[model samples]
Target chain A: MFSYCSDPETLSGLTWLSCYLTTGKHTSLYLSFGTVLLLLAITAPIALVFGFGGASAARSRFVPLSWLGKAYIGIVRGVPDIAFFLFFVIALDQAFEYLRHTIKCPDWDQPIRQGNDFVVCAAAKLPLGDAPQWVHETYGFFLAVLTFSIIFGAFAANVLYGAMQAVPRAQVETAEAYGMTHRQAFWRIMVPQMWVYALPGLSNLWMVLIKATPLLFLLGVEDIVYWARELGGTKTPKFTDYPHGDWRMWYFGALLVFYLLFTKVSEVVLGRIMRRLTHGQATMGGEAQRKAAA
Target chain B: MSCWDTVADYALRSVGIGERLLPRSDFTLCQQVTLIGSGMIWNIYFGTIALLSGFFLATALAMAKAAHSPLLRKPAEWFIFVFRGSPLFIQFFFAYFLFLSLKNVFPVFSPLTSAWAGALVVLFFNTSAYSAEIFYGAMQSIPKGDIEAADAYGMSGWPRFRRIIWPTMLRLAWPAYTNEAIFLFHATALVFFSGFPATQQMGDALYYANYFADKTFNPFIPYPILACYFILLTLTVIKLFGIVNQRLNRHLPQLQRGRIRLRPMLVR
Candidate 1:
């Protein structure tokens, strides 16, 4: 990255450290932080959309729909969420290919799940068999994000459903008296007011999402955890320029610091959002804000 | 081998009382069910032990947080802050490495790396901090009416607290405590993924399921079975917690009650 980095051996102390940090793998590792942030950026809105749908479904008049939504919310409570993360990555991959196989290769006849192998035709493979390595990695990441959004959306749905119910009935009734339909009353009155109630839960969810970014490694996306493990493994002369005995402990330590710092920053930002959202609202937090403002 | 024989030979595999070698080939549905269910025993053991121990520690920490003395409060506050602030994944990694390093400094603590000790210690402190935060919230929110009633009756100091404060805190905190228990149970799955090796392949559900996934290259079967076990376990948790919640709220009238709600928690 710098002209002085031409001879890594010639560099020593700070210069050596600078040149070492500028390596190709190091660049990828640095870029991967952007990947984590990008994941948070992409997944949040999508999860919210899923959560909204789920929350609405949970309150639907129909029995089955409510049951489905309730089941979705209840699913994550038991067992472990990591189990879901591990399971869904594979399950969703196969489901995608199975759908593609049915549509893309009508002539294929062999069972997809025969014995142990999920043998979808090459034509139906996600990212395509002929695609580049980046496509494959991005495809894996996309799936991970989708899986994460789905699982978390269910939990968010539970929170949002409660928040929606917390909206005062009189406000919705007042909107109705203004000649608005149920849908409009919902969109204009309940939805607008529900934010204050949901803010606490949503902020909590945001932290969970931030913490979840490290699990991308388990999904095989080569996030910070992957790079930490890779760069810090027991390096020897045969593998690369730098030789070091198992530095995983140090590498992971740095990663821990990175995560803690990120979480602390998130806490600060979300705390601001809570203060903003709660002002002039009816909850205890809003009352506190009102007094503070006075 | 017949399914019956497979069941007899490997049903208790996770507890190390059954077949030494896991089924490598000709894996059947029954084998997956039996082995994974066996693994649930470990998950329950970790969750139950950690939760029971964490309950007392959490109460103490919560009390310390509410105490007048900084000497009592500072350590408890920092403990809650650090544990609640970090991811359980990193906690697992940090704890394992820290334990491993400790072994170098003192060989007597070598067993700290085992699944039983290592995983339990991590879960204990992790759940303690989480429950401590919950208990603190409950302690703060303890109704003024109840305290006033206690004072009116001339109940003071330890008697006042033992009679009026403790029950109210537990009642208020029960719902959140249930959620913490569920999370702690889920967090047990990280044991195998962390530095602690599941000795003799005596691993949790995920470990066994992942092993099968690696061997079969087909995640369809084993993982879902693991999921089923977890889903069922979660339902049982809800049911159990619900029963306790009912007992906690028994003094109150039905109309003035709640369903014992839970909020989503981050980190562990």
Candidate 2:
């Protein structure tokens, strides 16, 4: 922040606005955008990995493994995902703390749940009771990422499973005829080819995933929605240099435009990717490309 | 309290009709089930009413998007884009605040500030946009031959659409619209979580489930109970839609009747 920020009351118009925007809280608000992007960056790959595993397990010859995968994939279909989010954040936290409590405080003779409170040993607390603020924040964020990955993983599994099935049987058979093992054929033929089929679903999931980031506020993260509400409320000039009356609509309006632009960009990029993936392939898209070229 | 007594007291609790204070300690399974089931009334109210009203708006919007006039098409396109592109969570916040702002401007908008009116309006618009896009896609894919056949018979405009195009569009769009309905039901759980205060503890299933979770310090029970209720609600929606779908395609041959497949796609 500028030295001019020291006497913000004297400044008016753009000068006051500039200083206000540079405040520590606003900086945090700006950084939270990075947090949203980081979450998307981290969760997408992790969810894809989870999806791949789930899809494979669903297709496994082992009945129990297949059942596990089927249940994992089907669970999200039944429950509202926000319910899963709220449930998992608390449930996973308690589960972790409970595990740590059993391990770390084996001799402590106290019921963990005592009349509406989950009382864990101090040491068993996630990020510990003495841990720094950032540690707790990071721990909460990590849990959120995990929850997002788990829920979105099921959706991605649905997409990938369908994509894997869409791969022609003959392609895998040809890989087998070339003396490749089942695993090798799967890796070479099925996995590589499924992307083209999965792109549409995956892109849609990406858009949904983007939209769901605002729910991070519900998960108790200091994300954009939290900041928008906090900073956009009526603040008197007595308390602050630059006071504003209920500007939450403007803040949320900005967020709306941001999301709209993001989705538009994503659509363009996904379209290009789809075209690239389809080129010189056996699908109708590729055939059309070939026809156009001829 | 006895289970029967508890049920009698809290059966309609979510709508402010029954018990004033929820059960504190000694939370029984019966209490959880009965209370959560009571809360489900709001979910059913929001979902069915929103979907029923949104269906008509969505049909009109879909036709507008598919219309030849740019004026109609552009607004329709933007309406879908604005609603579809943003998170419903934020939409709820934005709408609640907007309604509050309007209440200051005019006393007539005061009732719209409440969750029952405000949140329902958001859900209505949200579902309308989603369902419109689905219908628009279906409209685009309506077989050219059918339209050509209608043209050959001199059927045009409203008559052509009413007799031929609309039914086929509905048939084609039914499966996707079913998915949208399910998502809308799920999205209704978000109403209370947003800016809307669940006045007098009259909240939806998630709200009660959240209350139980907060009270018990154990999320394992209440969330699943809510999920079970929702799963049943989802199945019921599918069943009801399936009947309507059957009716929509009654004139078609059995083989050609589009089978309703439940694909749980994106949530708002």
Candidate 3:
């Protein structure tokens, strides 16, 4: 921020905006993009792992395990994912504290749910009752990531499950004939082959994941949407610098552009990847490859 | 109040037919269930109506996208891109705010701030774009043989489209459209959370569930109830769509009647 930013009387347009956008709070806004990326970076893999596990379990020879996996995937399919996001945050928070409560205060049982109160023992509080502000924010964000992963994991499971099935039955048979065990056949043959099929669905899911990041504000995380609203809200000339007209439309418009560009780039990259993946495979893409080679 | 009393007071609460205030103290299982169940009316209303109406628009848009003219195709392409590329959550907020500004321009449209009209408009456009994309994909994959046969039989333009092209498009698209319907239903829970104000405590299932969660300081009961109601709603949708899908594919031999498989696609 320019030193001229101290007095609004002398401030011009760009100078005022420079001070405004560079404030500590706006810095937080910028980092929140990192937070969104961090969430995608973390949640994408964890959710995929859960999805792969769920898909495998669904395909398992064990009837009960398959049933459990199917139920996990199906349950989320019915409910609105936002509902799940809302439910799981508090539900997970309570579950964590409830476990902590039981362990930490074994004898102090004054009823955890006491008439409109969710009273855990003092020591059982998440981040402890005296933890720093950052810990609280981090915990809320962690819970949000968990909730997102769980819901999207179910979707990923459905996608991955289909992809796994789409892998040719003859390929597995070949693995079996080659003396590979069922588990070995699964990992060595089926898993690797499934990626080409899974990539399309996973890329779609990743876009959905990107779009869903704004829901982080709903979960009370100080994500980009939150910062946008905060920074764009009405302010008198009294509070800091860079006073202006209602610019929330502009802020959100910028977010819209950011998301659009990101998705566009993803589409291009995924298209190239699909082309590469299809090369020399025994599918439609492979036929295209043959034609190109000829 | 007893459970029966709670049911009587709030069972139809979301439609403004019952209950003055939501139960405050001594929250019973009945209060939670009945209130949340009442709230489900809104979700079903938004999902079912938007989708039913969107189906036709989607078909038309899909046709336009498949059209030879760039003029026809361009608008369809942009509509699909704009809706598909953005988060539905932001769309809701953006639409609500945009509509709010419109209400100032014309106070005659004050009701747009309410969920019934505003959210439905958003959901309608949203599903239309998504389903249109699905239909367009299906249209592209319409069996070339069937179209060629239609052409050979001297069927051209509207007649050809009505008898050959349209039927094949619907048949191929129904499976994906069913998936889209389910996603739209799930996405409907977002209406109340967005900028639309749920007047007189008249909100969707998720809204009531959140209310209960906040009131009881325990999410254990209400949210799952919401989920149960939704799962039931989802099953009902699948059942109904499966019947339509069956009817669409009635010409097929029994072996060729493909079972409806649900795939997860982002709703809007």
Over 4 Å off, model 1? A1-22, A62-67, B148-157, B246-259, B262-267
DockQ ranking of the models:
2, 3, 1
* Separate DockQ for every predicted complex: 0.56, 0.80, 0.65
State residue B36's C-alpha deviation in candidate 1, in Å: 0.4
Model 3 lDDT, residue B149, Cα: 92
lDDT of 2 by residue, A130-240 (tens): 899999999999999999999999999999999999988999999999999989988888998898899889999999999999999989999999999999999997987
The whole-model C-alpha lDDT of candidate 3 against the native structure comes to: 0.87
RMSD of each: 2.7, 1.4, 2.0
- Candidate 3's TM-score reads 0.95
Candidate 1: residue pairs that collide: A78-B234
List TM-score per model, in order. Answer: 0.92, 0.97, 0.95
Task: State which candidate, 2 or 3, has the greater TM-score.
Answer: 2
Give me the runs in candidate 3 sitting further than 4 Å from their true place.
A12-19, A238-240
Better of 1 and 3 by lDDT: 3
- Per-residue CA lDDT of model 1 for B145-217, tens digit only, reads 9999999999999998888898899999888888888778888988888778988999988899888887777
Question: Compared with the true structure, what per-residue lDDT tens digits does model 2 show for residues B1-268?
Answer: 6899999999999888877998888899899999999989988899889999999999999999998999999999999999998889989999888988888889899988888889999999999999999999999999999999999999998899999999999999998898899989999999999999988888899998999998998998999999999999999989999999999989989898899888878688
The number of the candidate with the highest TM-score is: 2
Q: After TM-score superposition, what is the CA distance of residue B205 in candidate 1 from its true location, in Å?
A: 1.3
Better of 2 and 3 by lDDT: 2
